[model samples]
Target: MQKYLPLFPLNLVVYPMEALNLHIFEPRYRTLINECLDNGTTFGIPAFINGKLPGFGTEVKVTALSKKYEDGRMDIKTEGIRVFRILDFQNPMALKPYAGGLLEMLPMPEVRPFVMVGLVERVKTLYRFIDEENTFDVNKPQPYSYQIAHKIGLTLEEEYQLLKMPTEAERQGYLIQNLERIINTLQEIERTKERISMNGHFKNLDPLNF
Candidate 1:
């Protein structure tokens, strides 16, 4: 079903169930947030790629107004609720300062057992490589790929690509491949560092038998 969503174009990609804390100082966005707060509505945060509104964006609902200033600028916490594909955008929606567009709500599938398990292992391995004592864990109940997408070293474009994938299995596969590549790269980097460090050290060398 297609419905109008308030558009808040951002440089980053927000995944479902991800919490985003935003400081609303801009006049237009301030009004937008205020309206959403008053009306109990949601907004779309479309990833701004190369100065353009991209294909997919996450619909986020404000969870809390953490802080309200005397000047009307406020700090808000929002959680991504769902994914939406933009059909068309209006620069300024009717009389509103912010933009709004018709969006087709997309369905997200549940994480497949096999791919999700591998993805989680790959993520844990990535964390171990980055931090010797790894303690990163996705939010529980049902751990999915979005929980770790930002935690893993995915570029904004890559995250957007992940969002474009309709099914959780596809997302999991994408993340697993990405994490594997990253883990391999880090391993190679560590090996290079070890090789470089060994350059100045005197190693006990054994003569090769001819």
Candidate 2:
């Protein structure tokens, strides 16, 4: 079944079960948020690249809301519900910055616990390295697939690929491939650092002169 929903395009990719915090200041999106509040409705979040919306997006539930000012601005926290594919889009002639679209729900496969656990472990290891190097501070390990996806630095295109996968196994496979690549890249960096250190030590050695 296809239904029309208000669309909110963003530069970042949102996955199922992830939480996002948004500040609503634009007039059009503020109207959209108000509509959702009035009707207990959900909205679609599509990735925007070069001002173009991706065909696939996630439906999100507004879990928390607060009015920010007398001007009707709002601060909202939302969690992703499910994936949807855009069937059609309509852009009114008005000056609204956001776009609205007709969307069809995408079916999700039951993900296995073991596979999910493995992926989580991989992400944990990656974050551990980040914390050790003081590159970033993530409070705790994320508990769900979407959170893991966000932490792994997946591009919007790659995230769309995950959303399009028809089965849990396929998504797991994709995550595993990305995890392997990340691990390899980190290892290469370590090797390069070791080589540089060794060269510096050799350069410092006292020269033997006859």
Q: Listing every candidate in turn, what is its Cα RMSD in Å to the true structure after a full C-alpha superposition?
A: 2.3, 4.8
TM-score of candidate 2 relative to the true fold:
0.81
Candidate 1 lDDT by residue in tens digits, 1-210: 788988999999988778899999999999999999999999999999988887789899999999999999999999988889999999899989999999999874353233456776887788778775555454452237777777788888898999898777788889888988999999999999989999978889999999
Clashes of each: 0, 0
- TM-score of candidate 1 versus the correct structure, residues matched by position: 0.91
Give per-model TM-scores.
0.91, 0.81
Tens-place lDDT per residue, model 2, 1-210, is 676788988887777767889999999889888878888999998877667776888889898895567898999999887788888887741455567888998864343233555765677777776664323223333224444666676776887777777666677778878987897788799899888888745366687999
Give the candidate number with the greatest lDDT.
1
- Clashing pairs in model 2? none
Q: Name the best candidate (by TM-score).
A: 1
